[model samples]
Target: MNSVYVDLAIGLVIAFLLFSLLVSGINEGLVRILSIRSKFLWAYLRDMLDGAEGKRSWIPGTIREVFARLPFGNKDARPKFDPLPPPVRSTATTWSGRLYERLREIDHNTSGRTSIAFVPPGRFAVAMMEMTATEGGVPAMLEQLRQDGSPLYGPLKGIWDSAKDDAEAFRKGVEAWFEGEMQRLTVLYRKYVRWVIAALGLVLTLFFSMDSLEYGKAILTDNAVRAQVAATADGGAAALERRLRDKCPEHPSDPYACVTEILASPAFVQIVGNAPVSVRIPDTGDPQWLWNGGDWLNRLVSPAHWPGFLVTFFALMFGAPFWWDILRRLTGIKLRQPDPTP
Candidate 1:
């Protein structure tokens, strides 16, 4: 096998192995870093990044429930829910959170510090999964509170209790509802983060694909580009005029004879209508053909040749990633991930 091919195979194998191990480490870290109880970090992050904002909604509702249970908390504050519009709600879904989680895992391994980097991402995934699974778990917990009449029931009962003062309970309920919502928000944030990461990966893949094509085009040009230099000597122009007039004495309709006469004319240049003619062959003294006679030049002069710069510029810019990736691998330079935080 060629040496370059051998090197490429070896390099690819190594990169694959490294990436695999790296991803595995990240998975483990996510489970370690994010906690089930304190997962509000993820929720808050998601709410901030994703377009899930609204006036009043389940967020405050959940918060109110939580506060109503507090020992010193007011029994009367009730929470209200206001749903956000579709666009803002959709925007709140962040792929950046997932990206951050993945990057955190990678950094933990690569940073070479305590090597505890594997812990965070592993925990994050677990926390995210739990959040989704438990969005309505609070209601179950409240049901349990109703049956047992436990201290935990105070806040839950107070926020929604028929006996509590309407205004005070509503206010407290809203506070507790918001607090609980903050938890669910973390889950949403994690999911959004993953989404963002997937999106970025797709975009990068597309750019690389285009880059590969352009790089290939450049390589083709290197071997196949034909120089369009003129073939005839400077003085040969005069001789051709003499030939044209003689052969076409009565302007023969025969194409071959007309061509022969044109070749012999001294003022051949003038008879050809002053269009620029390129010489056909280099270093040959006896024969030369006009470059303008070919179909290629005819096409160039056509009306369709309008978008010169746009076509040329696009071709030049395309296929850059293939070259870039090749260069980075050959030089042992690492590709940098985008920002770690959303």
Candidate 2:
């Protein structure tokens, strides 16, 4: 019983690590599909640019271009998908960096000494709005700001129009609206990732023929097969990990990246190299052993397969990293401890 339990543990750990990689890929895929980072950046900049007090503002071309690429960049498509963008680095060459350059440009024009990350919302609003303002009151100022016909103007104009005649009210309302949008963005990203994980997990489960339902009978009675799987599991696990070693980001900023990296890793997406190890059981016909009394029991099928599916899916939400962490610790301890069976 103990030996059989050890085999089960070995097989399960390997499965989890592989499956977690699949889940991670699905999560990242969804992020790319939505173009979440670009959308969030646009929302933030839209908030900063809105001013109803006849204030002038400047919108950088670089920032506007990125915004145009937002939410998949296809205005006419029902849902558009884009290739994943590179990670946002703090340097100016990346999307986030370009936005910073624009912020610095704004600060230079306004003679305000503020870092891009911590610029006050109201201060930014005044700078951007007033820059575009011309020699006139609200109507003339709005006309100058809206002249370029940039996509950003639509949202900014909405804020201006909502004021009717109250510039200060419009300013406050714009910031408030932006804050609400920020909150919604967080929730939206989370929900999107979860749905992706669930769908991908199910597909992977089927692809790998991890039909725990089908394997249950053999697992319960076939000691020889389990022993073979356990003995070879470490090698199989190492192979899988090697394939995944460069596939995922080692230290990702969020769940989305972690998942994407796992998915992108070089792995067998099907049951080719991913199947369980098998072994031949000794066929001693002599009834000298009690275990030989019922060889046919190995073929007995369990009707309760849903439990395996449910347990696997639920465990996967913990992600590949969580299981990998434990696997690492166990391996460390295992390396240091003397083998009991030895």
Best by TM-score: 2
Candidate-wise lDDT, in order: 0.36, 0.47
What digit string (tens of lDDT, one per residue) describes model 1 on residues 24-49? 34433543453222233433433433
> What lDDT score is found at residue 111 in candidate 1?
25
TM-score of each: 0.19, 0.39
How far residue 164's Cα lies from its native spot in candidate 2, in Å, is: 28
Candidate 1 lands at a TM-score of: 0.19
Q: Where is the poorest 10-residue window by lDDT in model 2?
A: 75-84
lDDT tens readout by residue for model 2, 110-143: 2222223234456445543443342255566456
Q: 309 in model 2: Cα distance from truth in Å?
A: 2.7
Highest lDDT scorer: 2
